[model samples]
Target: MQFDRKDKNDATLLDLYTQLLYPRMVEEKMLILLRQGRIGKWFSGIGQEAIAVGSALAMKETEYILPMHRNLGVFTARDIPLKKLMAQWQGKISGFTKGRDRSFHFGTQEYKIIGMISHLGPQMAIADGIALADLIADKKQATLVFTGEGATSEGDFHEAINVASVWNLPVIFLIENNGYGLSTPINEQFKCKDLVDRAAGYGIEGVQIDGNNILEVYDTLSDLAEKMRKDPKPVLVECLTFRMRGHEEASGTKYVPQELFDLWAQKDPVKCFEEYLLEQRILTPESIAEIKADFKAGIEQEVEAAFLEEEPVADTATEMQDMYAPHPYQPVEPNQQSAEIRYIDAITDALKIGMQKHNNLVLMGQDIAEYGGAFKITDGFVDLFGKARVRNTPICESAIVGAGLGLSINGYKAVVEMQFADFVTCGFNQIVNNLAKTHYRWGEKADVVVRMPTGAGTGAGPFHSQSNEAWFTKTPGLKIVYPAFPFDAKGLLLSAIEDPNPVLFFEHKYLYRSLSGQVPIGEYTLEIGKANLIKEGEQLSIITYGLGVHWALSYLDEHPEINATLLDLRSLQPWDKEAVAAAVKKTGRVLILHEDTLSSGFGAELSAWIAEHCFEQLDAPVMRCASSDTAIPMSKVLEESFLAKSRLKESIDKLMAY
Candidate 1:
């Protein structure tokens, strides 16, 4: 154990032998497996092992490590079981995701590691949020998130680091500047001398080190990790390493120059360290060979056993449960003398209630603190909950949601305001890909509520007024709650904040004041998937949500003879299938309507469902009324014509006549 190391650990640099060997062995084995048609794809950290192993060893086991796709050394350093790792590579049901996913896209709570998705930049923000969660809870722990120099080009990288800097979060933004981002060279990426130099823009400490020197990385990070406990803040560390292999095993490196490759090959971190250890007389040749043999033997045994494990069978009955894991609805009878408030006010009330009940509840968005948000939904949240809880962020949707995801996984319920639902496009990657798939990928909980102000009625135009529920309806793991009234807005928000999954709460901008109801004054969580059967009838059934539900009511009031059942489908995903089936079966004819454009709207899916399941009871073809298949025009006349009452009336008349 004798070695030249000044790390916080009592252990010497020799302890990293196993950590260094593991990822290299895994890379070799994965390449073999890929050739044998056993594994799909592999991104090898062939030259960057020192960065991963050293940084991971530098931090405590309690601290979190959010790894990138190529950070296999992090998993190795974390001491993840060889058998489980092999099983994951083999895509066995015994793996982290139950063989539902493959590759480096799985993580578990036990390891304090977050799995990597394809987009690496967003994880930086998630790391920020996890660090923020601990900071708010008075916990002393930091987060280490890794990425390649290529990821620095992403907007999320800037957004994430900026937020980390602003909050002084205990996060280590590590960049493996591996010369090339997949295939594009570093010169094509940025003008900065070193990637760490970008840290100056965020007003954080920037340091570049010889990543091949494992002792240097270990000592630096170990000391930094200790300092973070006392004074938490972000540190940008650039590990000047090389990706010896291509982006993936199959992506050959013809674009790399032979001379540069030869130079780096001579400076291989593992080979260099092994030579140094031998020179220092730490571990003899026989001991090093023995250690290598043990790693190889264990890897061979695990790979063989994992290869023989039974494949995951598709039991859709259980597999489908990953789409929406709703919190079980506890029957909450609202107390008497409950105050009634406007829909917008009720939103604030729900946030207050959520914060009061759960100290872990947090809110983040642009203009959400001092200005109280673009719509003032979080008017007093900052004052009441304090700046740490209710944070005002720059206009970075992806970072907000990404950090929200981080907060949720770290025992905090995070509410992210999208400012405008239309702008959700900015954070679409975080919300749809990561947030929607976290649970399904690794069985990880993502308790995030993305509050989106949706719909067009006040001439807010396409950018501000979009019924984007259809966008998320297509995503599997997200629960879409479009509250049509004040009571549902408050109750469903409470439920959303309480739910153990990511929920997209769409509050209709037009209905913010146009619709109101007697909301319960006390804490109450309404059932998420259940629809409010606004009006019951026998002739025609109208399935709608959000502002469409109100429009249906207006039409029903004007034409009593239509004999319609207005179903306010509050939750779009994990929708009340039983209620919808019964309602459609009872009414024979169904009309699906929404404020979103007709083409590919949720109404299309509803129409198809009715045609598929309730065709036997149907006397007429299902009718659908929606805004025309065009952008919501800025002109009031054009917008009105696009979503006119006449469209609904015509559709109803045809259904009745049929």
Candidate 2:
């Protein structure tokens, strides 16, 4: 139980004990708060406090820590204000998210701690991104990510670890195996007895230790952290602990037998560690009682302070803060000559322009280099940009996006191709948690662009025939752009590549070859967030984007009497709220349309915004035109009926009647 290292002195042990006890008291207080209805439900890290505190102590404050939901212990140990922590539990504006986020979804970049992404298994990938950023900065700081045994089942965990091993990233994957993943026990979750064994598959070193032993956890983590600092490779440490409480405060022990609970109770990690401390003559019973009493009083005082704190007023201007860096939008010159161009050619030209302007630019995806990408958008890019700049990766979506994040932090303008937009779901964690929140969390920009071929009506069917722009639109910090014409495609793409934030550039597969438009011959970039008025009218505003804009334009050509204003929102985030509001006010009628599902679709956001801001200007109720909630079918007849055009025409007719 004792350490031989010189650093492991009495002072270190006292610090470790203090670290362990504080989080324990916080977790206990949170459970009581939940019962009293003062705070929301919580995920407790009761018995596993030793592992959380110990591993956190081993890491320097300069190093980044990406914690999972159960790492409240580590957050407390890292000096995250106890009052703020309690405020987060109470769902108050004083919390990290200002009451926008749920309990356990807290974070502070000031502490060098990346926020805990609520997703079950993306923390490992995010850790890789932080480490990559550190490496790019030429700093020695490392990244440590905490997860549970259950998360190992996710493909992102393996994909992230594998890439980290291949690149020798300075990251430590700390798996807190508390025997159960919610309800499924570790024994039933995986065939292997030890989760660390899986690390061998990725050609990485793996270790297992007694998570209950604070000293043991500290020694192992400190040793690995030192190794990571020097060699800079990914390591997995499976800390075998036990869940002393239910998964969450709301989860009862109905499935867990009473006998098994009694058996595990005797070996409770907190109690066992306390006994060890007593047996080693490290402390007396009276001293332990005094420590507990002090912790309780401290927590009570922090809770009182948090409850007395005033809530932050919701600011409308703050919404525009992290959307993109503060750069004045420059309009393309009116004299710029236009020429007919192909969609793929436009993409290639945009990449070339982006790379020439930004020396830190990097393009990556499966078959993107020599193979020229699945759609030939990157054809000859490797030869033109060199292998270092344009690289082809293996068919691992999670790894591809995860590594892209890493490279971006190193000062690279990364343009990652998802092959097809449908495949983006595979790397959803990297897109949503890491890329989307990078700017919002740290105020540091990640100039990364994700290019994916989207939309149905191309016979791609179910998996391949999805329009996923709605997904990214729902997520904050990401600028979603879907260009219908080749000109906007090139111009908007160049803007996305140049911008100092994440952009989800969606391309319609059908429009790549089927549609042709005039694009400027020379270098010119278009501003994102500006809506293009294809046709100005006063009868009704036909608000739409992407391919839907083409449909609205065509419909406008036939129905000139309707005098509908066709608004093409080139960017979904930081969308032209001003233009939309003005158009809605002038028209006195509005029709929101998109090619996404009707329920919880991107149109809902547009409708909600208009209803809140331009409600008084409306002459009629706001109308929505979107695809049905059913999945995209293979039949052309079914697709035509379910797509945006049919819905657009019908909704427009109804709006005119009103």
Candidate 3:
């Protein structure tokens, strides 16, 4: 396909005008819905219709689009039914979410339109991933991501653009420079003279277009989209537009400058484009009026249809659904076999076995390929499995995880490795908002396992030495697992790989080589949500997971008089409440321990659950042992002082005394 720099002939001006006007009516109708209490709050793309409509028209239906919250125009242009969009806003079954997603968060697989994530900038990284999938699938489709100019300042935008440029992915990043981000002007948010110029730093072509000029937008985007599909290089286009209304229906424009608002209103894309069409003799005054009337009528019809539409009955049931695709719940046999194996080797063995069994599985991370990964967990596998299966990615965390989500969406099992658990924050948005909720919102499954080397006590400073499992455990729909011994690591990891949901598998860096335990030689799997009883006692129940279980067991061994039951919660989500209740009932005491900080830690949740369910059996108040609320220090002495260990035994002893 040849890239065209010129606009379509004047003959298509009427169609362009009609397309441009449709989104405006949609926006107005949505505002009405909001005012009448038919829909919740909405972010409007009033003055920026041209950029959304024109760019959308530039691409073919097969091309993918990842829109932002304010891109209702783009959604309309892509043929998403107005009633469905309204239903989504109204939290009804007729909506794309089936009544679960937040307002403006709607997706359609058939339309090739990924939903708009409320997060500001992470969609750019996701767009790059989708583009990468297209490349791998050998599909001739370009991926377009839309974001506000303010989103350009986010770390994700920088990371995604850099990776996209380096990989030369077929992605077109369209920044709707709508003058202000919420209330702050773009000038105060970014140092660059133009948002597009920032793209140059990533070694990608950058262009700025008149956002109100539909012809210019269509011409530039169509050209770039085609060029990207053919040559496959990232391009950044900044659309200088205006936000005619407040950020959302709830916000007011009392803070905005009246003069600037007036100037932008004069340059409204709809009015400006109509005049331009008339000047070119493509649209007469009567034709323009007729087009506007027709669009308004169409929008009203859509609204009426949406109001009368029957919401899907299945939407209510979908909310309580599990992450598993095709099926929700299936009981599995627990791990029973026991044999000695190394922790790190167990991880490698699980990956090898899972990959050999499941051809759809693909593993990628920095130094993971021939380098065998930083911890050598993926050693000797790239050569045997080939680069396609065991791939090495750039040191871009956001891009790596985002691409992993995209790959998972395209029917590939992705095992993404983060060198250290602390660094996973770089891709937090991808994990929390995208991968974690894909199944919950879009009714699609993401069987991606994110493996990270976590925990401190290894003299690696604050940045390198930290346990962030708690950070991810708080997110919904993500299964968090931390294994102390080798056998559980293998079994739990195998289960995570097979489970059709996103899993955060935290491998303690210190325990990988230091800890040794029995792991079965053959294929074995552990139930995701079930906890194990390491020791059965009567005095107290120490609820812990990962390395904490080891410490608790060690304490139990030392104090023969102290009969404390230890529970290792392998899976954080869908936790074993029954086992916990049973342990508390038998022991009549509860103590929660973890390596994370005390404030809002995983231990708090466990304590709360125990209190809510097993309060009657408690002999004394439930106590929690956790690290101090501070960044993990670099000094070994300080790190040791910060972590919770034998002090927990003291707390237990004190509780026993109480």
Q: Which candidate achieves the best TM-score against the true structure?
A: 1
lDDT of 3: 0.81
Task: Write candidate 2's Cα lDDT for 191-294 as tens digits.
Answer: 98689998889899999998878878888898899888877888999988878788886896566777876876765656766766677677679988999999
Whole-model Cα lDDT per candidate?
0.85, 0.79, 0.81
Across 309-344, the per-residue lDDT of candidate 3 in tens digits comes to 776676445565644454344544545665677898
After superposition of all CA atoms, the RMSD between model 1 and the true structure is 2.2
lDDT value, candidate 1, whole model: 0.85
Stretches of candidate 1 off by over 4 Å are 1-11, 32-40
Which residue pairs in candidate 3 have backbone atoms (N, alpha carbon, C) closer than 3 angstroms, thus clashing? 339-518, 339-519
Q: Rank the candidates by TM-score, best first.
A: 1, 3, 2
Preferred candidate (lDDT higher): 1 or 3: 1
Residue-level lDDT of model 1, residues 207-320, one tens digit each, is 898887777788788878888878999999998888888888789899999998899987788888788777867778898889888888888998888878878989887777
Give the residue spans of candidate 3 off by over 4 A.
1-12, 30-42, 99-102, 249-267, 276-290, 309-339, 386-396, 559-564, 597-600, 620-642, 655-658
Ordered from best to worst lDDT, the candidate numbers read 1, 3, 2
